[model samples]
Target: MNQFNRQHIGKRIAALRAAHGDSLRQAAARTGVSHTTVGRLEAGQFGTSLNSTLRKIAEGYGVTVEYLLTGRDPQHDFESSLRRLPPEERNRLYFASPVTRIRMLLQFLMAEYPAEFPLDRLAARLGMSPESLRRLVEGCDDRQFTPEEVRRLGEQLAKVTSIPLHWFLSGDSGELAAAIPPEMLGAYVRLIKKAAEAGVRPDLLEMAIDLLILKHREMPAGSQNGRRGG
Candidate 1:
């Protein structure tokens, strides 16, 4: 790409990183690139031949390579506007329980394109019977979706709604976790669960939990969070 295009891609990368709540180091780790490389990419200072690196970054962010290079994905404009919302509001919408967010997204698609997305037609498009789709949306016990079923739904949702497939499967939590080192994410989730069990106020603990994860990540592998090796 030319310098102008390179800079534009860099800006898109930065935006994607921010929207996913990832720092440069975290993004680098996730993409298997060095932290300095990620910093350089965000600053538009990459060498010629960035195609491989760009693909890796795009994969890390659960975005298409075209979206990263051209910012022209179907969801690009909508996701950009979402990123501009106050963090609290964005978090509330994105971090809602998976079922709730999926329902909200369905409602949004239905309302936004009522003529195009009537229930039976939408169900047919999803390769499901209308009653099955209804049960899925209504969370009926008889129609509970298996993980594979959810994955299939996510793929169809991505096609129809222009939302990322992960949004349908894991909501915002999956996006955030994708930005973190995979090895660390499990520990972070455990910590969050423990904090909740201990009666820590979730809103207040949010920042603390993130800080703790960052700190723990810096420790040598196999070391505990705070304890030093003998």
Candidate 2:
């Protein structure tokens, strides 16, 4: 709507939900997001949300998420798409449609390796075909999976990336601390929390820290001691 903002987008989501005759709790139940989060999205209080969350919201609102985000159907005008919308959201221009962050770690990791990558193993773990898994990580956003399925997806992705489950679930970077060995977890979390508070993109910060760790591990012992002392 006005100025492509989060607040306006939130207003749209609220309007669409109300027009659909679904209360916050009902929408949350149908969408698999918590009611509190649904309220936050309606209030424009959310930041870059996860794509899985958006898919659930799209299902709750009865529109393909692409049409919802850009106000135009993939195949036709916005009006034509509304012919497919659940009657209530037609021309309700105020639905919150902020751009969401598809889980980036999955894409990054998927590309980092050679072609011999173990897609089948990951797919078997998630109970999906490799094709379906590729489409999902590539941001097809075509379906609203159940919360349990989403959790399993997160768990599997977390294992592959060695990141925390919360990162996969919510896009929160603080979860990077969980990847640390238990002996260092408390200190790492606290330090990373401070870095996160500085308004850096926490994911990028995590990558930089990861590279530093690898470099540290590979350094000669004398140089490592010298650098540490310096």
In model 2, the worst 10-residue window by lDDT is 91-100
TM-score of 1: 0.39
Give candidate 1 misplaced runs (Cα > 4 Å).
1-89, 139-143, 172-230
Candidate 2 has which clashing residue pairs, if any?
A: 9-96, 12-94, 12-95, 13-95, 13-96
Alpha-carbon shift of residue 124 in model 2 (angstroms): 22
* lDDT value, candidate 1, whole model: 0.68
Candidate 1 structure quality by residue, lDDT tens digits, 70-172: 6665356456656887754564453444655556556655655455568898888789998877776676652265667767877977765458676766544
Model 2: lDDT to the true structure: 0.56
